[model samples]
Target: MDITSLGGERAAPFEPTFASAAESYLKHGGEERYLAPIVAYFGDRPLKTIYPFDIKAMAEALYPSQSNATRNRQAVTPARAVLMHGYDRGWCNFIRVRRFKEEKPKRRKPATAVWLHAFSRQCDKDGLEHLAAIVLFMASTGARISEAIALRWDEVDLTARTALLLKTKTSTNSMRYLTDEVARRLRGLKEGNSSTDRVFRYSNRHSVNERIRAVCDRADIPYKPPHTCGRHTFASTAIELGMDVKTTMIAGDWRSSSVFLETYVTPRGTPGRVVADRMNVHDFGDI
Candidate 1:
């Protein structure tokens, strides 16, 4: 019998891989080369959509109604998976791989001012004031944890009420115009009047995170691990008062701050229902 009549059809009884075995099987010219013809058979007459179905069903036989044979249980699922693999590894053009259905996203715990204040207060009361200051800076400015630890007193301008937030999680430069309250707290800190010393230089460079975690345990606030709390807090308040996304992006140095604003920092309140019962949008709403 011909190769088409033999066992060369269907899923081919093998896992798809980047190896020559899989590639040769997938290619047009080779021993028992039947993939191209089979694919053409699938594209014959009318085509069927494969999305929103499981690939397991494609291994079975076609249905009784030849009319609905074109609408069989997703014959393209295995091919789609193979295409995605190729696309992921940068081996070939697999454009159909981009057609992904987004699953229900996991929810995250809301970071609040009360929680941060409580965490900082715990640190202060426990005599770990430096770590508390770090927490304060994080909660108010939305600066990254690493950036806060790398801070030198010289980079901070107490007169200008701003911290020269230079290093960032993203490989980009940024500056923080600290909120008045947070700036005042930083200015009043008795970090010795030495311009050359790092602000938290007494401890090892790695120990900044260590002491923050230890203090968090002492403070009794939720221990979800410390990071970018100040950034979160700053974004939260700016969203509440209605700051433009462009302004926020410039201040925070976010590459796509507009996208972040829409996803994380957009206000969900209705002014009409919230204040005077009108359905008009605020100027910052589009921001």
Candidate 2:
């Protein structure tokens, strides 16, 4: 009977415009680049009034010539994140935007051992042992360029053949054991370097990649980016050498087996040769 007194007066509704929500999201450390187009598209629209179709339309209008992956990454994903941030603040209902369909990508070939060898030789010829060591470290340990660049001497244990990856893309520290070759190279670099110093002298990934591209060009080898030459090559080569999927995943710090298998474990260098040799298959006439 006294429900009105019990409930008291209803509070004013919390309504935030998309622009304000996005501004709040950015202030809370959200990526600015992704939210830029979304803000420009929706401007001061109420967060609650935006729908999935509106977001999709925004993506289409903003990125007409871009691929589905680009649209989703730059548009759909960021928009959803901002809306979710708003929902968390009780300014809007939670919303889900279906991503655009992406076609299956063609398999990328990892750098071969021969290609790496040539690349290393060129680096050595140019008196760039540090560059050689960088690629080798990446290829041996499946470290990303950023991880490799961020590695300090103290994080490495040559005796134990392990390095701690502190700046991993996964946002977790990872321990990666080095191959004997990588360990030897690290030892050589350690001689004159302080434990407090970074293992490589490079300041950024772009410079390293540019140096790699230059070396590849001089070596007359096809240039693959650091990701392809290092991490991708490590995974593919490890599996090709008969390392088990689980072991490879652990070594590469791949959290998802499906992603590792589908994206990184591509067959390379006459994959059917071993089977063909074992089966002894021949031409029909010869048979």
Candidate 3:
């Protein structure tokens, strides 16, 4: 992988300032999301001067102002990108940068089936069929809104009861199961639709949120959108119904069981009772 011969005798050594490297790697290299934050932190420093400790400091600095997800994306992603860039270019050896440990946010309760039914009925009443479909799909599949919006008819396999999600946050296509309810709604929506067509047509998340708020106002239920409540509901319901962790993780496309447990799955009355009943077995004979 030596590039020395590519440039010949006049090739300069591969040394870029942090600003130049960040620009080249984050912006021009196509991960523009991290550009501003990385530049703001170490824009003027030399790339060679950056150490693991510097990354730790950057993460610490981000703690007060940003969420753990945002902080990691800002500080860690760009650093790794730059370091990997240097390695790929044959200019520097591998450098390890420690990322900050993010505290798992408290689990949000999923939207109840009752709430969803009321919301959907309200949406239909208000002529928001599209929004209702979106909510129903997310609640049924545990899909993120982005995943739902990016879905296509071609990705859905009705016979197999699965959908291939190509535009996921993980940058990898995921296969999510389709419930009978969701499949029915999706089938109705896709009637006379082409494979290339998007599943739902919407302007943006903001508009969707507004529509959801209107539906909630009419339904007389709390306005927790499917992104929060729907996903939570999917996980919690799966656990409550005794679906295994691995199965739930695969269906939801969660990378790890720990993440599924800590973030998405919130124990509720039924599961709590079951766990308590199981604990009785471990009790020392009524001691």
Best candidate according to TM-score = 2
Give me the displacement of residue 89 in model 1, in angstroms: 17
lDDT of 1 at 177: 72
Whole-model lDDT per candidate = 0.56, 0.89, 0.76
State TM-scores per candidate.
0.53, 0.82, 0.72
Instruction: Specify the highest-lDDT model's number.
Output: 2
Off by over 4 Å in 3: 1-16, 20-32, 40-44, 48-69, 80-106, 157-162, 270-272, 278-287
Estimate, for each residue in 93-194, the C-alpha lDDT of model 2 and write its tens digit.
Answer: 888889999988776689888998899899889999899998998998899999999999999999899999995888899999988887887788888788
In the predicted model 2, the residue pairs found to clash are none
lDDT of prediction 3: 0.76
Q: In terms of TM-score, how similar is model 1 to the real structure?
A: 0.53
lDDT of 3 by residue, 1-287 (tens): 56666875566755677677766665545576655766777877777787888876777676567776776777787677876786666645678876667776665567877888898888778877778888877777788888888888898888887888895887788878877877776777787889988877774677778888877887899988657766778888887788998888777778877778877887777866877898887878767
lDDT per residue (tens digit) for residues 92-147 in model 1 = 45444222333333333435767777877887688776766776776666676677
TM-score of predicted structure 2: 0.82
Which residue pairs in model 1 clash with each other? Answer: 138-230, 139-230, 142-230, 142-231, 272-277, 272-278
Instruction: Compute the lDDT of residue 234 as modeled in candidate 3.
Output: 82
After superposition, the stretches of candidate 2 with alpha carbons farther than 4 Å from their true spots are 1-16, 20-33, 61-65, 84-96, 103-106, 269-287
